[model samples]
Target: MRRNIIPIGDVIAVNQMLERRGSALRVHMHDACGGQSFSLRADDGTSADEASRQAVGEFFSARGHAVEFSAGGGDFWAVRP
Candidate 1:
């Protein structure tokens, strides 16, 4: 299975929006090949980074994929099965 890497810029933008609104948000994406998909929702009241990670991690875990985040803080990739 091919991996799906979420861009850092996208994550950073989403994080910034969540931080500004202090509200819940959802992000949905499908793999380039259209074989896999993910939906993530982040609730309000937590740090943007943490909430984003939790949502992304849950999406991957439910689909039996491993979640990996970049060291710098604003990106993630899913290791496909």
Candidate 2:
């Protein structure tokens, strides 16, 4: 499995956002983004759902970067932020 890391500061920021949002952030399967299939999974063996994906995407976008994934089983890459 391939791995990617979001900086500790970004992580903390996301956590703080989640903490502030509380359970309202929980996403249902039907809310997935276009029913996209993600080959990359976290260390916990879970893949990102739509809400989390959007959050991460926004985080990187704010830094002038974009996260990309292959259509099949492949690694994740980020553009310069």
Candidate 3:
């Protein structure tokens, strides 16, 4: 089982890396609850899913929650144990 609440430092580092890479992906950290969420969109239409999948596959795969990518808009979309 994966732990949903990862270290805040890891989240920060990931965000920093994203910024450095100029990636459209962004990780939203919930400090009050230690939950993380991300949403991505690309002008090319296909980049959104690709980016979201890659981002989540690399990062959140080990976290407590799994991100389900869709063309939806919500900060807290879904959380699975």
lDDT of 1 by residue, 1-81 (tens): 567565545645554555575546544455556543444445443333665666556654664657666564444556655
- Tens digit of lDDT per residue, candidate 2, span 12-73? 56556655754233221111333222233344555555666666567657865466655542
- lDDT agreement with native, every candidate: 0.54, 0.46, 0.52
Q: Model 3 scores what on Cα lDDT?
A: 0.52
Q: In terms of TM-score, which candidate is strongest?
A: 3
Q: Which stretches of candidate 1 lie over 4 Å from their true place?
A: 1-48
* TM-score ranking, best first: 3, 2, 1
Candidate 3, superposed: residue stretches over 4 Å from native: 1-3, 31-49, 60-81
What lDDT tens digits, residue by residue, belong to model 3 across residues 1-81? Answer: 233555666667666666676766555655545445554443344244455456644665555545554455323333455
Model 2, global lDDT: 0.46
- In the predicted model 2, the residue pairs found to clash are none
Give each prediction's root-mean-square deviation over alpha carbons.
8.7, 10.2, 5.4
How many residue pairs in model 2 have overlapping backbones? 0
